[model samples]
Target: MILDALFFLVMAGLNLFFWAIIIAAVLSLLTGFGILDTRNRVVWTIGDFFYRVTEPALRPVRDRLPNLGGIDLSPLVVLLLIQAAMLLVAAIQGYLIRGGVYF
Candidate 1:
């Protein structure tokens, strides 16, 4: 019972982390392309936070990936990785539930 609870909590945490990455990626793309202006202090702050948090992950990807004209594909690659991780987690959880395993 406790194991089941813990598994659910961990799954929820993963979902939250995944969504945060998605949000940050979107924000970074928008700000990078000038679609979203950081005119207001609050906007700048939020955008800056996401930029800093996501840069460590995206920078390496950007460096390895060849530039396609002027477009950046690093964020798309990162999003795909995040989505794959989430799907893998869900599949593991489903398997555990089906096997009647609490953990």
Candidate 2:
């Protein structure tokens, strides 16, 4: 029972992390293209926060990836990696549950 609860909690955490990355990626693109104006204080605050938090993870990928015309593909790559990690976690949890392994 405890193992199942732990697995669910971990899965929920992974989902939240994955969604944050996805949201940050979309926000970055919108802000970059000037489609999202941060003139308002709230907008600016949210935008700034996400940029500061997500840029570190994104910078390395952005540097390694060659520029593709005007569109930056690094965020897409990051999103894919995040999804992969979440999927891996879910798979492991499923395996443990099926294998009757409990901690």
TM-score of 2: 0.76
Where model 1 places Cα greater than 4 Å from the true spot, the runs are 1-10, 25-36
- Per-candidate alpha-carbon RMSD to the true structure: 2.7, 2.3
What clash count goes with each model? 0, 0
Position 34, candidate 1: lDDT? 92
Give the candidate number with the greatest TM-score.
2
Error of 1 at 40 (Å): 3.3
**TM-score of each model, paired residue for residue:** 0.69, 0.76
Query: How much lDDT does candidate 1 score?
Result: 0.78
Model 2 alpha-carbon drift over 4 Å, by segment: none
Cα lDDT over the full model 2: 0.79
lDDT of 2 by residue, 1-103 (tens): 8767877887787677667677887887787889888897887888888778778878999899988888778777887887787788878877886887844
| Number of the predicted model whose lDDT against the real structure is largest | 2
Model 2 weakest lDDT span, ten residues long: 13-22
Clashing pairs in 1: none
